[model samples]
Target: MPWSLHGGSHLPGCPGIMEEVDKILIRSLRLSGTEIPDEVQSIREFTTELIVESVVRCLRVINPSVGAGLSHILPPGMSARFRIGMSLAQACQDLGYQGEVGYQTFLYSSEPEIRRLLLFLVEKLPRDASEDASQPVGKSTTLHRAIAVAIKEQLAVPWVPPACRTPRLQLLQGSCLLKRFQAQPLVLPWESNLVPGKVPPERKEFFVKFLPPVSAQLPQTTSLVPSLLERNMAELSAAQDWESEWKSQGLGSRMTPEEYRQWKLQRLQRRLLDQLRQASPSLGPAQPGTTGRDLIQLLGSFGAGHERAGALAKGSRFTHTQNLAYKQEAEHPVQVETIPISRTSEQELREKQAAELETLEGELGRLVGQIGDLEGQMATLGLTLTQVEGEVRQRQLGVTEQEQTLRVKGRTVELLPDAENNMAKLQVVVESSAQRIIQLAAQWEKHRVPLTQEFRELKALHNSKELESSRRLLEIRELHERIRSAADEAKHKEDLYKQLLVELESLPKDVSRSAYTQRILEIVGNIRKQKEEITKILSDTRGLQKEINGLTGKLDRTFAVTDELVFKDAKRDEAVRKAYKYLAALHENCSQLIQTIEDTGTILREIRDLEEQIESETSKKTLSNLERILSDYRAMKQENTALLGRTRET
Candidate 1:
């Protein structure tokens, strides 16, 4: 019904561009011009193409280098199409002939237009020009003729051209003003001579209620005069007959003698009934809707109308049915609702598990790596110890040879390996040094037992932690899997809840499904959140387990140093040993303290996360949402609170 086509031409360049897009849109849309008459469609297309073609034509005309523009003097009696073409050309030339076209050889040639504006004007117009430049010809005559033809053809009427005569408009000056008045017609009671007959007693009483109070009797006046009285008497007689014509007692409710007589008959009937009751008294029982019944029953019988009366006449009573029959026929109504969940819960669980598992495995691996490092250091220490032992053995063997040498030649040098008896002294010194080394090695061996024991204990602790961590990791993983499964199921239920929500949201206004859906959604959301939090705890537990395992490894390495303490050089190594022992003790204590802090921090964070989950899970939007979902789920249709004990025990 709305015409959207932009028929006026502001179309630029080739019309082909718009034509192409239009064709595509038209074809794609499968739009039909069936609603438009063939003539209008043809006209629309023709105008559109004409406008487009005209633009092209104007552009061709304006591009000329020397000739005057064709639009300068549009032909007299030109068609609208031709005029439109001329305007198009002039517009293309950018409001032609505005300021100046200076004779510049550099810009444009100065050759005058072969068909100049003056020549074209004189040729096109049906007027003669005056010598004075301002003197005018009848400029609008040609345009007027064209307009006359267009108006005649388009409007299908004889073209009555606008009058050229100078016209004046004035208000008519006169005193003929409309007076404000009301027309009152005296409608005489006897005007139409519709003198109505007396209404029956029953209808009169039925139609007119609230009878007038009884009034005291009144007297009439006497007449005077003789001949005047005689003439007056005849006139009075005529007037009395006329007065009967005008009289109307039907509009008034003052009872006539007949109506009064009927009312008195009704009272007489009531008194007769009472007298009969007193005399005989043993009557049949009264019935409803009979004359004996009260007015209210009569009205009520009519109020029920014919349908109920007919039903009662038919004797189709609604008697009690068997309890089993009632139960069998009664409807069993059931409602099913679902819960909602986050879409990414499954993926989140997986990601958490992945990261925590990586951390756990990484820590265990790192402990293994640390053990390798400790082994490397121990290997180097062992190699150097073996070298020291070898050198000490070689020197000790040389000392024995020297002692043998010293026994033969030096008693004094043999005593303490002094330099005096060189070989003997060297032998004794070598023996002493070897003995010190051996004793120290023995002490080192003694210390190695406890150190090894400590290391074994630490390793056992590490193994225990690792086993427990691994078990916990398995549990965490299983929990993750379970949570993932639960989460997925939760999501499934949640999706169902969302679907229910969408259905509920789409339900008719009066349906109870929305409240049911909202309640279910809240429950689902809480469960999903709880699942997510549980998954997170599993993730955190794995990571903390890894930290404990790492601490165990560190403890093992620290205890290992105690093995190096006991040696022949115990006195010399006392400070070094104590230092090592103190360092281990300090590291172990720090590890335990840090582990506890980190564990507690992790726990608190988890608790806070859970609390947030709880808050989010409970969507306390409106009072109804809260009451229907949480505070009182079963409450129905109540805007205000009910008595407390009225809640269902279930």
Candidate 2:
């Protein structure tokens, strides 16, 4: 017995040997049917009973709230491999349970939660409660009640949490103060059950007694509470009207209440130093011997004792007006000397004719500045004797009466540099005959300026034809009366062309009878025969209106799409409703990520056998060479989901 799962094996290959029992019974009979294996020793006894029933339900699925009396706490040589579905694979390799739990694929799919955990534990199990009960893989009576009925049918009641419904139970039934004590915290309402003779009129025995007085036993206290002794004698008559103003100003009969409080504190510091010398005539004024330093800024602004310091010293006055000055001593006597005068005769002939008219206008302004320096040296020596007398009249007009600039200006300002080189060679022969007499007087003013503007525009057309008048003397006075009225209208048009040549030999005639020339030859042969039968019925009504609008937009979008691979029973009932919603959301997220990785009971079952080989390769069907081997299986499942989403996001 101990060899089946607890104490070990069914011998032949020892230690919980049936390795993943015929690979989970040929992947659960190829996920429950789909002929893939015709038999190779029937897939080796179907993976040795799916690895001896997943090592006899790997420790109730690795502690999923484990309890089902762990199959009578496992040992007994795996008690025939924990009965019915056998294989307690050596009690799950001696209890250190590894992964995968098939308990015959959880009792052939949760037989009503392993029969409600075999009627909840059913007293530890040596099997039968009418046998068929516990079934997380056929016939196991307990695994602590098939893991306490697959963890009490997998928990999850949570979603009902926010209980307060019905407008928050009518807002907590309006804060139920016992519904305002309409009383039920033990209701009585005159003992409620209504009218038992109006509940209370019970008369039995009676007793009257005279009980009263205690000063007459004493408790009434005030022997003079005349209104609390007239409010404490009106606060002792306002403390005797505050000592009756120093006892009617006689200063308490000459002082001694400690000298009448030091004569009312030196008459409130001499009426606050006469109200701070009548409120500051310069802070210095208070010094009539430090009137207690202006009684500390005038009794901290007037008002302490002595009838408020005798009304602040009868309204304090000596208002210190001082700033004086005035003087008066300088009265008589003083002296000093020396003086003289004269000069008359019109003050000395106007001082000698104004000193002879200022020395004759300073010798007439130095003889008019030496006659303007000899008229600027006789105007530059009369321009060098007028350029040596114009080079001796251009050498007497070029030796007509001259030569060599007339012998160099015939020597004057001493051969003025050979008369300035014979007056620069007779001024370059009078500037080359005055530039050919200014180019023949500018070509005689350019051909005499359009012949002097056409002789002044023909003297303005002889004074505008002397202001016009004759039309050749009125055409020779109307050519003898227009040649006698055109020879009397050519003798009256030669007798009206001889009476129209005798009425054009008398008669007349018509040209052509025309009804618009016979309606233009009958509209040119009826517009050439109704233009070829209206262009052949407008080309067959434009190709049947383009195939009836392309068959009404292909019956609204390409023959209405949802062809979902038409029938093989609607593609295997849509791939068994997409493999039961992708293998039950991939076996419920791979059994909650392998129960959060074996609930951290780590012994890494290679990422839970690679998430049960990605849930049997996502319920099959990806062909094209398995989509080219699932394209590097999505880059190794994106590096194993980025290393398990960074190990479950930290």
Candidate 3:
């Protein structure tokens, strides 16, 4: 048997394995007088080294002597650096790995490859050690090898934890790891040769000879290692010694490999129960009703108890049928009771009829309201008809009174001939005025003819006088030219006389002064006679022009009077024509008035006949209609009574 490490059972698994390995290393290092101030850091360093060494070992297993496989262990993009002299952390870090933390993470990695690698190391390392020691390896006298083989075959294919593997495989793997605690000569480097196997020579072997001899009996069965029968027998024998070592209490000899496995499983169960208790401390004893049932349930969980019937209390009220019903209730938590289809349909028909009845009742209410409104309207129409009848009678009385007044007016109208005579006398007076107007017009025409003739003669005379005045003006202009020429001649003669006097003064005593003086006096007398004659002619022409202007004014006045008389005669003729047109219009209007009177008499006779026919028709139709309305009203009342009875019955 291998010496067990202290606190090995208390430690859990993978991480616990790491911690145990670490403690061994620290103890060894401390024994060598190497003080580690921070033990955890030192342990991390050692674990990193172990991980790197394991990788190298795995690589060597692929191919010894470091061939192309060595490169496979390097991080993908790592340089081909020398790892021989380098620390594991430094080498791993240089390879782009996270050194110690990465090694721990990889050890617990969920990757199938990492898991396989770790298991492979655990399996190979101890077997290799046993081989080196020249000891029997894997030759145990037990059935574990077959079981381990079956488990390995079942878990041959890699799978994610808790999802793919069967519970049996999980239990086997767990048991196998627990079994590793008994491994001889611990496989970790720090633990090698540290645990001594034999007692020291200086110590007395007090219990060695007293210990029981080992048994050479083969297992009773080839199929089972530590079957339940053997385990129970061992437990019974061990019951007498409470303080005996659990390992030593085994039946076969001491704790056989099979008994050790059984004890370990029990211990694991105990740990689970303790943990469950810690998680829920209020887990009390089973209730009275469930205690016996729970005992049966517990017994049923045992593999061998499946064929046996449950044990029950003698006075218990439970039965197989009731248990089956309870089981069914548990399976289907909510129960739904079903009803018959006929009942359901009847309920639905009742609901539909109720809804229709409610609708009919509402319609009846509306009809009643409408009937009340119609009755009120009929009352109003009746009152209005009576009022109209009274008004018509009053109008008839007023029309009769007006007709009497019209008869009185007709007698007065019979005296219109006297007024006609008066009108005829007025007409004679108008005729006489017309004749007088005609006579006056003729006299005015005669008077206008002479004036027109006189105006024509005066116009002719005025034209001749205008021509004579123009001729006289031409003669006066000629006289003015002659006078101007004579004056110029006289001025020339005076200038000649002055020059002659100047010559007379410049001449000798022989120059003729008397001749020059005689010439000057003759010229002066001639100038005076010419000027006086021109003045007389000019005065005579001006007098003739003034007389001609006076005659033109007189002629204009005469023509204006003739124009006024002619305009008055035209206006009077227009006024007489207009008066004749008015007389013709009056005669035509009188003829139309006689025709209108005849038409009015015919229309009034037709209106009286139509009114008599309308009264006869109205009297007949009103009596028939009133009889029909009374019959309809009585029928409607009977129908309403019948409907009310039907509604009440429903």
Candidate 4:
């Protein structure tokens, strides 16, 4: 049987299923803790909103084009709510729901139906909706996702008044960027060079200094295409420069492109600051006690006098040395003195060089050994560090588990004293629940027996009625076929009659056609007389039928009054009881008789209708036509067979 709100036994797992459905719906709808009640039974105004929003969201996920523009909330007005409910019902049906669905199913929904519908909708939701975010995505998709996240975050922030907002903070606020750009007058290179020749001085001054911003000059509804285009072009140019720099120099730099760019920006800022400082006036003159001279000037001043004294001393010393050298040369001029020189042998020199080479080689070997030992120690340290890290992670995990256990144990300890009382309460609840279940089962049994009997009785009645209807339908179809056959026969007979008349006309002028005409008139007259008789008979039958109906009703009324009066007397008197019995028997006999008469009348009507059909068919000469058609068909068949035989022989 189809499911009904008032009927059907609840499944044992239905509550659990409903809970799961509620969780999925709550999560998907993003309902806050306070927006909806903890229990489904407590839902009121929010129920309609939740259901509508969830259905719309699921529909959109399933088929965006079809679900587009569907309202996510129920309307306040009764008619509109009804319309929305009807639409949602239709949409669900269109999605191929097998359950019985109507506007009432949504607007006046019960818990079970709501749970079923929500479960179906959740199942219909796109699989990709709950896909893992950790799944790989393309650069474009990732970029778009990031952009969406940024925009969402920006939108989530409360709006600040324009007056209190900073430019950076208000980047995503309204059309601030466009308004900012519009507030500035667009200055072109050519326009900057334009001289005001024909303008008045006052007008020129106003144009230069007091002109309103571009936004004021333009209409409020004016398009920002030009400004946007300019901005995009500027961005594009900067992007091109960045790309070029990154490829040419940034890649080879020790820093990343971003870091390199930052460094360049810092250098540019420093240069700008230096330029600004030079352009500005000095703070004050140098102090009187302090020299303004740089290191170069101070060093030059100290070295100048020292260099002159050294030159003069060198000149005086040179003269004295020359005189002394002259005296020494005069004394030593006559002596050809020869000094003896001692030189080491070639073998001794080679031995000393070899000894030094051996010492240097030994030192190089010692350093190589030390370097190898250090490398081994470094490798050992790295292995030890990795082991230590693993141990630390394990300890951290253990600590976390211990903390969780401790927390659970602490709660258990807190509840230790009340455990017995809780257990007693729980036992009482369980006993009460068991008793309630038994009571419910007994009540259900009480209702079920009567309902089941009634259902079976109704089913039997329905089956009998259905069979009667089918029989009547068959009779109707048979009558229709007979009528159609009669019509066709009539048409054919009319055509044959016309053809016969035409043949008679084409006959010789001397041929007697008066007798045929007279016969046709006589036949028509007889048919008219028969029709008149049939009509009179039908009128008489209708009169009899009305009288019978009136008599039947009168008899039923008399029987009811007589029985009421006799039943009272029958209780006290034996003869009256016998009389009452007789009266009841008479009434039953009369009712049966009436029924027989009605059945007879019905049969008579059907017989009359059959007779009329037969008469029509007879008048149309249907039998003769059929015989003629059969004869022609046989002749055709014989001719075809003869033709086939001749062909086969050939």
Candidate 5:
């Protein structure tokens, strides 16, 4: 058998060595907060086993033949040293360090070797293989160029700047030389002036030599040539100034003099062509055929340069004339008498203006004060208006209430006579009612004793029936309670039956022992007997219920018969009572008829007396009363007319 390193098979007699190593490892694992495997028992024993196994593994890695002999690595006396060694190796391995040297370094040299070995390994490792495999940094190739082209293609533009030629980025290093020259791309406008106090000499020369000569050539179109040459010279001088100005400004130096000259020539030709076209508008818009040819002629025409020269000459001449005038004015300045106002008048005028200003200021101050006063008054008026609104609302409410009271008074006034008449009629009815009540009371007194006796008898009978009904109600309640108790008992028996069924189902079928079998058989027999007894009881109870029902039917029949006999007796009593009531009513009716007859006789006598009195009274005073009433009515009407006239006068 051979031991192996890095998870290999174990040799014979390695168990003891392995056990020692395991003990040390387990101890170390426990210290490191690792749980010991169950197969490793205690730390010391596990350490012993671990050390032996690790020693064997290490020895095998060193030499396989030595691994076959466990004694070579694990001697009999070096158990502790062996445990320590194996623990170190395990710790190193667990921590992801390679080889037994790592463990030895940790224990002996305190891991200086690990750092050195790490540095060495890092150095030995290839640097960024993907980067090496990729395109060399900063060394742009055709492929990079192709990529750039692809980018430009994707951008849908073909032009690339010289700055974009290299892959090396110098973001802030390069000068923005193109942007410096951006504003002066065509020509520098500063070239129009050479210095602060001096005019351009070329402008004067052109005015004298080229432009004045054009006045002589105005009669012939062929005279355009010399002026064109003069203009060309002036433009060339301007272009030179532009170039010099651009250089002085240090904007850009890359633009060539030839390119500048060509650009200026083209611009000058364009300007000349435009001016020529404007000057000769009768020619209309240039024909398409001559348009290109005319442009070519303008560019080629040196005479075209004379046009700018002539304009510049005219401007310079005017400026020269002005300068001459200015010089003459400086030499011979005009003098005129100065009219001066007296200091006293000036002081008086100032005083008058000051007084006016003071008055205006005072007026402004007063106006401001007035404005404040007006604002205060407006606020006071607003408050007053609010108070007035509240008061008006209150007055309106009071007026509405007064109107409602007036309406109520008016209605009362309208109803006063009707209320008085109703009172009189009600009084008369009450007197009549009093007499009727007296008569009815007498009648009621006459019949009340017998009715009271009858009522007393009926009340006694009703009280006896109520007592019987109360007894019957008590019996019925007792029966309902008994029935409820019987139902509860039946429910309890049903629960017990269910419980017995569950037990029967739970009992095993294999119980063959005499005691269990006998007990189960006895319980089943008892259950069956109980069931039979319950059934018998139920049957007996049903039979008893049937007998009770029969007895109840007999009792009901007997009660019904008694009730019928009682009803017959009650009916006979009721008939006798009704007959008494009828006799009483008949007696009352007779009395009422006798009273009515007496009342009628009295009424007839009273009526006869009233008629006699009415006849005598009417014969004596009817005419006299009518005459008095007519005279009084006429007097009242005259007095009312006089009162109306007096009210109208007031």
Candidate 6:
């Protein structure tokens, strides 16, 4: 149930979904020339090697730190193979696999289990942002991808144990990166104790006796801060280099200064907002209020004024024409006095003055409107300031209350050890505990008496039974050895029979051969019947022997009990003593008679077995073959003698 694909809902059960999973896994793992069946029923067509390699590759893709340490190939030795299986299973489990997992799950993998594991791994494969074909890759994205790849490559290498690692102390010690770029320890040279000729003797003694050296305080080799600082410095250097490059070349590459300035301003604003958000993530996106908008507009207006000034300076120059005109009027004062003024000109001058007065009144009204707007803005700011002040006062009050509570708790802790009432309560608790322990010990003794007796009795019984079982086990082992030997003998006889039959078939044929073959077949059939009868008789004998053994043991136990009872009574009466002696004699005689009967039965069984063996051997015609061989040898000797006599006579 745990192996059920919860995240991979579209996988395993359906053919289409399984196919998709298979294809994705194959492509991602680069399983070339491997074909997955279209039907789910045929999923087992996947070999163990293919499955292991695919799973290992998928794990690497998902989590290189764990997967990289595992071997893709199964090891030849059973123990090493088991270790690898366990490692892979553990790695999968560490990657949040909820399914049941063990070494057998990987080493002795089944189709359904493999399918589920593969689907899980495929689902966990890291998705690439560049997978979206619609979006073009940027330089930053490319750089980030390259970094990720490099890190993954580094992580994928299996780590060597510290004891097995090659020494690199010299390389690390002489490296410029460690000397120039490493973080320096935080020092307080200006402190009174550290300052030259200002350190107190007591302080120096404390430093030497109690405090560690500065190197130990902030270790450059092992401390996390140094590594972090080193990394930060590296990043800072890279950023500075990029900034300098941009200033020298990037700025000039732009079409105009205005465009560059606008881009720079936007970049700075974006960076400022990012910093603000990081500083206080709880505060979401900033809202553009009226005050902020007004400030932006004011800055824009100032920029526009500067642009206008630049344009004016580039276009035309200003001249002092008005000053020259005033000088000319002063020099021609006598001529102007001689000229007479008309009445019509005076009337036109009065009309012009009235129009000018109306325009001045309109301008004064506009200034009053601007003042009202400024006053309203000031009032809003005052309200905001009031709210902030109230929040600050509330925080201060909370801090003061916390401090007071801390002081009260501190005083209580300081006095708690010396409190007389508390000490008295502790003594009472200890006395009560001691009494409870004593009562429990007494109760335990009461329970332990009967339990100990029962345990001893059970232990004795267990030992007797164990002895009996051991005796039976040895008997069973002997029986097994007998059966194995019997089986081997039977097999050897069978082989001999087949070999003789083949030899007979290869021999020259004769008219009498048919009769001989028929006779031999009949003999073989009779031997088989005899063997069956012997087997049945042996089985029956074994059964009777078991019954005899049981009855004998029962009789011995009965006699022992009866004798014990009679003997106890015999000590009190002469009649009982006589009866006890008679009883012992009777048990002895009966045991002898039983033993005699068993011996007779064993002798009869052995006699029957011997008769059967003799019959089977005779049925094979062994004596007839031996007699014919003897006659042939005599005939050859006679012919040799006749040939020697003929040679002598010639």
User: Who wins the TM-score comparison?
Assistant: 4
- Compute each candidate's TM-score over C-alphas: 0.15, 0.12, 0.13, 0.23, 0.17, 0.22
lDDT (CA) for every model shown?
Answer: 0.45, 0.44, 0.50, 0.62, 0.52, 0.61
The TM-score of predicted model 1 comes to 0.15
Q: Report the lDDT tens digits of candidate 2 across residue range 12-92.
A: 222122232223233333332222344532222323234333322333434334423434222222223325333332344
Cα lDDT tens digits for candidate 1, 222-276: 2112233454456578766643432333113245545644565566655554554
Candidate 2: where is the Cα deviation over 4 Å?
1-51, 61-184, 187-650
Off by over 4 Å in 1: 1-508, 512-515, 561-571, 591-650
Give each model's clash number: 7, 28, 0, 0, 31, 0
User: Model 2 Cα displacement at 288 (Å)?
Assistant: 97
Worst 10-residue lDDT window, candidate 4: 1-10
lDDT of 6: 0.61
> TM-score ranking from best to worst?
4, 6, 5, 1, 3, 2
Q: How well is each residue in 1-650 modelled by candidate 5, as lDDT tens digits?
A: 01112111122223443333333334333332234466755322323334334334433433456445443233333333435555545534443455445333322222123233222222222222111222222223424655976777656744446567443223223344223211111122234434434547786566555554434545554445555565567779876676456554322333465565555566676676678765532233555446557866544433423433222222333444455556655776645334356544677677766886796567556655665565567557756766897799899999999999999999778867899887787799999999999999989988898899999999999999888866776675577668868998898667656655544454455533365335445544554676698899999989987996797688557655755665555666977656555655675686688679779989999999999777655633456546745765676677778889999999
Consecutive 10-residue window with the lowest summed lDDT within model 3: 180-189
- Report the lDDT tens digits of candidate 4 across residue range 159-227: 898888877667767574553434223433123223335456776777778876555554553335556
**Model 6, 1-650: lDDT tens per residue?**
11223333323224544443344445434532223444423335566566777777777777778877877887655557668878888888988989998876765565556667776776576544112222334445556866987778756755665555445533323332354444654442234223367588887677667776555656555454665576567668866675555556554453354455556666676666656444432234555643345435434534523443221222211122333334544665423122235645777666766776686556545545554565467557656765887799899999999999999999889869789987787789899999999999899999999999999999999999878866766675567668868988888667656645544464446434456346445544654676698899999989988998899799889988998898899999999999998898898898799879889989999998888667645633457536644664576567668879999999
Query: Where's the lowest-lDDT run of ten residues in candidate 2?
Result: 320-329
Error of 6 at 213 (Å): 64
Please name the candidate that would achieve the greatest lDDT relative to the true structure: 4
